[model samples]
Target: MANTNWAGNIEYFPTDFHQPSSTEEVQDLVSRATSVKVIGTRHSFNHIGSPTEVFISSRNLSRVVSIDRIEGSVWVQAGITYGELSLVLDSEGLALKNMASLPHISVGGAIATATHGSGFQNQCLSSQALALKFVLADGSLLEVDKHADPELFQACVVHLGAIGALVEVKLALVPRFEIAQSVFLNVKFESAVNQLMEILSLGYSVSLFTQWKGDCLDQIWVKRLPSEPSPDRFLNGIGASKAQQKVHPILDVDPVNCTDQLDIPGPSFDRLPHFKFDFTPSHGEELQSEYLIPQPYAQDALRALHAHQSAFDKHLLISEIRTIAADSALMSPFCAVDAMGIHFTWKKDWHSVKAILPLVESVLSQYQPKPHWGKLWAMKPKQVAQSYPGLSEFKKTIQKYDPNKKFQNPFLKELFED
Candidate 1:
């Protein structure tokens, strides 16, 4: 099989992989099974924590159930990958506002943890849900949204498979557009942030990619609405500068040749993810932890990270910084606050990563950072509850939907006790 996941960290396989073709079958299986955990692409770094008789794989359920262009919405089976969805939406002249680095992750998986792309105007993928259809433990189908079941809707948006098995998702869409990407080397850190803010203000969407060890300051990708301009016009000033160029075409080139080349054209999805350049392939395996802090604290947080670079360099891959606007999804990291995401990819040494995590957590805690639900975190359930303003209300909704804890894994159970 081809290599999977940019992280290459997941390896455990369940005793059995159950693939149900329809929501009714999913419901029936859940009701009859003694214990089960939904698996989506298995892209997560943590194990599914099944410790159960069976594991549910949504892969076979892949399908686009419905689309309403006028309403800018799509109803798709939970197993559909972002790449597939993007292509499908493109054919219909519709697109998601933002998508994370790799397009291969499943929609269900991405939303379960609120995966996001960088842009001040963008929100987590879960925030795009207009509605969700889930299979309850009792073999019933529940369609929840802001209007249908307000509380449950909010709680389940980023539910982490605790409430029920997500069968399908209804996502909001935007008109399809083209993206222009570029890479800039040796940019002063402070100046880069200013330029990033400026680009984010004017572009439809933007991303800033940086490496910790090098002088590389930014690899930017900006998506422009198709109605705006042609290649020649768009490339005039922004395109010519070596410091403000694109990224896609050079992805397959040699790492040495990959330096400082600017102004490339490619799809929006390709430009957003980090594994684009093949040069750093065996940079060695790594562990990642990311936290979303309010934008006002971004500068301070970056400075703190800089202060620890000497200690960090021993086992760090790169530290990434990105921004996003706030949304109200109950479990969303960016919920209710404009935020900046700071991510750390540590060298594969577990001991080193574990040792450094607490220190990083301390700095983030001072800024009141919110952990990404799917990634490794040091916070206890109480800390998690305290971090999200709507935790109490969300738990109330969770109780109504999954009182029996059928979907509860050890990680979730510890974080959310009945």
Candidate 2:
């Protein structure tokens, strides 16, 4: 039997999964394989990691290769999870500027999908890449940095694993800092609707959660840096009051897996992510989908989603709204445009979620929303190709790195099949 994804929504096709313990071993396996796909921790919700013949698992390859204090950067194996990296950095009094809501995802997988945290000024994870090392389709090790190979690096950083296997990554780091997380409850939907941008800018990092069944938001999670003072009782004007107790992002679920809330101060790694590293985040049985729309259309997008509350409520478990700063990565959803990501965490029934996505896409179509690369979506190849201005150039870069298409998979074929 093949393994299912972390959400258990996707059952990978039957194939040999390789666990290479070293760079030389990874190169050897790729050189001999007829087809290959690189996977990390199986956290994806779709068949993006499926392989025709062989799949490379980087779990055993994880290692913190170096930490350059002078350069303020860290070089880590692609398989290492952000949580692992964070702990190492914290011990040295260093940190990454931002982290995704879930810390379990591998560094390479997150960067490949342009995963992001909630902050108007914090760019997606890929933006932290100073350099990367890939084992190309032809078994050649290629290294590129942003300054020396801007166009190729931009395209390669978020290539969706279409170019090659990213074996190592160098990321920019910052001085470690402390943060406090607080949850505000029952903020009127109207207030969030009216002051959407202002509400998003309320903290160093903010996340608004709802289930679309009520007139008000279920919770508003705010993570503030030490320098940013949080209001004593926030969003009171909108009927939102700080939660007296810790709460999970999904209501009714135990908050044991979540980070410390109620304004308890902790390290950046602990507060930046919604879930704690020691416990599973969100419900284990769920499917996720997210769309990134430019900030200019945020209000319109919010209204559009709200209008379909009735239709979406039945299939949805929870939804979150987050903001990401603009970036220059070629295929990132927020490429060159600061944007908002409207994320949906749905019940385990794939059929219902699949049926409803077209409706969701149709309504948000006018906004030219970019579907997150790693999540489930019903978008067509033409629609995806047209959404990114740099798609053509990105395709060219993929071809240059993998002329024989050894890295190609069914998913890539469907998206790039012009």
Best by TM-score: 2
Q: After superposition, how far is residue 26 of candidate 1 from its true place, in Å?
A: 1.0
Off by over 4 Å in 1: 1-15, 47-51, 193-196, 199-202, 214-284
Q: Residue 28 lDDT in model 1?
A: 81
lDDT of every predicted structure (CA atoms): 0.68, 0.87
**Estimated TM-score for each candidate:** 0.85, 0.97
Model 2 ranges off by over 4 Å: 280-283
Clashing pairs in 1: 101-273, 181-246, 182-245, 182-246, 183-245, 245-263, 246-263, 246-264
Which lDDT tens digits does candidate 1 get at residues 152-255? 67777987777688999999988876565444334555555544456444455555545554333544444444443433333233432344432442233334
In candidate 1, residue 112 scores what lDDT?
A: 86
